[model samples]
Target: MTQYWYNVRTHQVEEDAMSDWTQLIGPYPTREEAEQALEKVKERNKSWDPNDTDGDGWADHD
Candidate 1:
């Protein structure tokens, strides 16, 4: 079975584990999920940011 990864730096899905941790987000099960990595991060950050009041103290100006 092939593995998939989302390249954080390039914003692209990789077919195998070819990138370093600083530039990647996943060993996702499918290419579709890998492609949505940025969306997933945004959704997670949205939920986490509100509850993370003690985190960084930056407000969401959006």
Candidate 2:
């Protein structure tokens, strides 16, 4: 299957790991998902962060 990556440096979706790994977001299955890499990251961070809420990188963990 073809995997997609989001290039943080250029803010573009790539078909593969054409650039440095540090500058990439992920191996998302679709281009649309890759395009929302930053949003996905934020959402995921909020889910994982013990103090994340309201997408402010901090939440009321109570």
Scored by lDDT, the top model is 2
What are the Cα lDDT values of the candidates? 0.80, 0.87
Please report the TM-score between candidate 2 and the true structure: 0.73
Question: TM-score of every model?
Answer: 0.73, 0.73
Please provide, for model 2 over 1-62, each residue's C-alpha lDDT reduced to its tens digit, 9 standing for 90 to 100. 99999998999999978999999989999999999998878777787887665666556676
User: What lDDT does candidate 2 reach at residue 44?
Assistant: 73
Per-residue lDDT of 43 in model 1:
69
Error of 2 at 6 (Å): 0.4
